[model samples]
Target chain A: MSVTKKDVNYVADLARLKLSEEETESLANDMNQILDYMTTLEELDTSDVEPLEHVIDLEYRLRDDKAKEPLSHEDALKNAPDADTDYFRVPRVIE
Target chain B: MSSSVNDNYEAVIGLEVHAQLLTESKAFAPVSTEFGGSPNTQVSPLCLGHPGTLPVLNENLVRYIIKMGLATNCDIARKSIFARKNYFYPDLPKGYQISQYDTPICHDGHIDITTDGVDKKIGITRIHMEEDAGKSIHDQDPFNTLIDLNRAGVPLIEIVSEPDIRSAKEAYEYLKRIKQIVQYLEICDGNMEEGSLRCDANVSVRPKGREEFGTRTELKNMNSFRNVERAIDFEIERQIELIESGGKVVQQTLLWDANKMETRMMRSKEEAHDYRYFPEPDIPPVVVTDEMLEDIKEELPEMPDVRKQRFIDEFDMSDDDAQTLTEDRYLADFYEEVLLHAGNPKAVSNLILTEVLRTLNDRSIGIKEFPISEERLAGLVQLREDDKINSSAMTEIYNAMLEEEKTAEELAKEMNLVQVSDTDFLEPIVDEVIEQHPDEVERYRNGKKGLIGFFIGQVMQRSQGKANPEMVREMISDRLEQE
Candidate 1:
């Protein structure tokens, strides 16, 4: 129910984020407060109510399995941080 | 590192198969799901995990998984929710993959497999739909891993099995059954070499009568069915040796190096899969109604098991023969279609097993791609069945029909491969063979009955392979027995 410093660091690591000591502390505090605030809703005993997966009540939206035009290789890689002619280059991934 | 297989210990293996759905579009995007395209050319913004992009479900993805579930006898979930599994990898751009965690779409299914002639039912833990990650090419580049996003959002169904597989061969059979069912449904192409279908194994070892399971290791990067079997065999051996040497097995992920035939630790990758999964908020729950089940059931083709059993029962063929004939839907259909025209199940099956399958393997093509059709092949089998041509003549006619557009009989006549079954046509050849081989005939008359094979061979050679060996045997016996 509470966010610890190690939890914040672990989550930051998973998200590939590097946080300073100050940012980590503040983020932990903020997340704990948010969790504490959200915990109040749990006290209402809404166990009888149905759990909704999404906020919107619309029907399940599905599309036909038809291919549409995709972005060209150039347009697709235009925003990559580092890319070669055909691939997005990244640090070596050890298998 | 094994001192032979430890019979005191048994292996426990469970497979997780990821089958890429054969849909035209990506799972959550409308971009093409075509394989072998130029790198990243078939990707869309949503597939690339662009900001402010939302994913819509593909209708066919759900339907295909449902068909597989039904084929595997899974209890179709009335309602299923998608979940986000948080992780970090170069191939996964979303940082979190949209998967099914708590609520899978299909569950409690079972697949029956035969390992060493022992029929066993491997329980299905669950089958869930998810999207595929992009390709990561590590060996292609010198320093960095090259990534292609074309396969990022392609549809996939992950089939998880219960830990019922107790041997490497059982794992092989279980994987084969899964592949057969998916291919039979026409949902997945089941091509493992090109990454259309992939399997991961969790292997462990336990004492023969132990009630509890030992620590398990997850194996990845096995690209072929044979590799899957070998990797599991290696893992089982390694784990058993580790325990026998007073060493404890560690629960971690291992990568199977097929070249070296060993499993190595995938260090630092183990920490990346804590996978804090939660219900996906973007896509709503997919509800499967009764009507949907009925419609999909009607659309489901005859599964491999049913068709295989029918081949055994109705066609009166052996289990191995029926199995070979029904290995694929198209192959089985070709068998029946040929039978419909040829009217003899046994001969048609024999031709298919030997001649047809050899052609399929030799050309590395499927039944659909092979030059001969069912009707044409049936004509060939009918010739052999009606005794117009012998088996070798049938083979010759079949090979000639591959290049020519003529029927089997036409090609048989053109190549002088038709069988000579007439008593008048074959009597002289038989008589000539006996007269020429008088010394052998004397031995044959003195009760060396096996020399009849030599006599038949000579007669066949003299007639240029047109003499029916069975008929020649009868005619030669009648003349040789004149006492």
Candidate 2:
């Protein structure tokens, strides 16, 4: 369950994080130490221990299922980084 | 026609729904879950997955999830734990999402869904709590995308159902039922367009009598119920054709292309071992006490299914009518409140489900925002019952009621909605109309029984439609018999 420099580099690329080689190596050590500490739970016998799922047990709080008014086109596109007359358009999203 | 070949094929369908809980707060932090706020304004240190921050449980979220479990008849676990579903995505600032893996909150439940007059039970495998990741804006450039953390850390309950569905219609009905139940329970707003509720379907095919499962492809990005079923159907047929041609159906994740009405592969599927799931240590194990469970159970409200059954038995309403009213909780509650005042459950159900619902849908308005209150709606129904106005005139009154703040009685008085009661005063108008239309009156006297309605229409028209329809009919029939 330990993280290595290779693991750090792999995750960085997957998440599109542009990290320097030295930074990747440093993070690998830090993550590995954290993982090592977390493994302490594995040493405790949890075979019979039930996993806790929710903080409390309650059932069925329902709101009426009706469609509320949707945002107007102008209000919806108000915060778009780039916009045209109507649609929120950025640079070429797809080729 | 290959009828026998069609009989040999079976459709296996399963649903994976991601329901964003309608809690006031975020999943693991105290940040508000309000929709449409400033970007990243709701983010807390823990939500951003900062190094020093840890997640504290939001009690309301747990109550919400448990409520869902109860509605679905799920087994509520006394304890549950969070695990890291290891995945690397830009929007997921934590690198790995904290979710329930092996030990889900509830499991082994079933729900009954009706499609085309047939009822079937769909098995629920698990309902687990998970924190959602943010959105990736891939529209930035040809090779890159930006990330929005506003959606990140939103709480979600993923309800995974067993592949018991057979046809596209059945899948649609099952999805609708799930949406209804969750919305009725107030756990989720059930807004597909807003990404508050989302569904992913797994489709596969097998030869008749085959016990082994066929290779399944997962479909995503279905914003509507129709799209969910259509995407599954198209994918199933595609797999069937491919398999019949001796090609293997690849196991992968595919995104639904709404424009092309097809599914394209996003990535090859990965096994559980690939991401390396493990217990999340940053958060402690969640514990559920008996007292908390009891409090939640006691607070559970009436679900739609039960309420529908009650409406049918108590109100003597038709199944179709009851189903329509109870499908939306607000409409059902509105009907109930009006019945409490009007004392005519059947009539209230009909007017609300048919006339009121039609008006609401036509205007694209919500029941909550309807200017007509329950008391006023009941008053309208009562007026009709008391012979104060005819059904035709009731529509105008109802419409006017929406724009007018006055009560139904007040509006009736203001608009002169009272029916004509004096037969002596009506006798002259009826006689004048009969004398003026001698040909129609002669036709009616010569056994043109249907013409009686025409004569009554003339009287009502002369009275400006405020005449009591029953009294007008009585007067017209009596005068016709004499002629």
- Assess each model's interface with DockQ, reporting 2 decimals per model: 0.84, 0.09
Model 1, residue B461: distance off in Å is: 2.1
Show what share of the native A-B interface contacts model 2 retains: 0.03
Q: How accurate is candidate 1 locally (lDDT)?
A: 0.88
C-alpha local distance difference test of each model: 0.88, 0.79
Q: Chain B of candidate 1 versus the native chain B: what TM-score?
A: 0.89
| Top candidate (lDDT) | 1
TM-score of each: 0.91, 0.83
Q: Show model 1 residue runs off by greater than 4 Å.
A: B1-5, B270-272, B358-371, B401-406, B421-455, B470-483
DockQ of candidate 1 (2 decimals):
0.84
Q: What's the distance in Å from true for residue B56, model 1? A: 1.5
lDDT of 2 at A16: 61
Top TM-score hit: 1
